[model samples]
Target: MCLAVPGKIISIHDDGSLMKMGQVRFGGIVKEVNLAYVPSVQVGEYVIVHVGFAISILNEEEAQKVFSYLQEIADEGGQ
Candidate 1:
């Protein structure tokens, strides 16, 4: 089962090209994600990432809801 996680963009790297990259923070883990698909994304914005790519931008409220659901699943799996 594939999952797209919600995370906040911490930093971006664009070298005047179509290929843009950014560091996205998921909880305490940070990973580099491709930002070319989200041209209007800015720092501190929430994005849904899948397979190292930011597929879409989401509002903070939606992001938190998804996070909470994921946390619930994690907690259930631990028991």
Candidate 2:
């Protein structure tokens, strides 16, 4: 199954084009994500990431809920 995970944007890098990139933190893991889809995004914002792309911006409360659910799944060895 495919999953879109919630992560916080830590830093942003403008490539001088439409394709913007940033480092997103998922719990303790950080990965580069494409931010072009959400041009209004900024550092410290929460986003739903899938396949290295930030699909949508989410509020902090919603982000935390998803994180908690993922943690529960991990704790249950459901990965």
Clashing pairs in model 2, backbone N/Cα/C closer than 3 A? none
lDDT of 1 by residue, 50-76 (tens): 999999999767647865997899999
The models' CA-based lDDT, in order, is 0.92, 0.91
Write down the TM-score of every candidate. Answer: 0.72, 0.71
Give the distance in Å from residue 50's predicted Cα in candidate 1 to where it truly belongs. Answer: 0.3
Q: Using lDDT as the measure, which candidate wins?
A: 1
Candidate 1: 10-residue stretch with minimal lDDT: 59-68
Error of 2 at 69 (Å): 19
Candidate 1: C-alpha lDDT = 0.92
Candidate 2 stretches with Cα past 4 Å from truth are 61-79
lDDT of 2 by residue, 1-79 (tens): 4699999999999986978999999999999999999899989999999998999999767547865996888889964
The residue ranges of model 1 lying beyond 4 angstroms of the native Cα positions read 61-79
Query: What 10-residue stretch in candidate 2 is worst by lDDT?
Result: 59-68
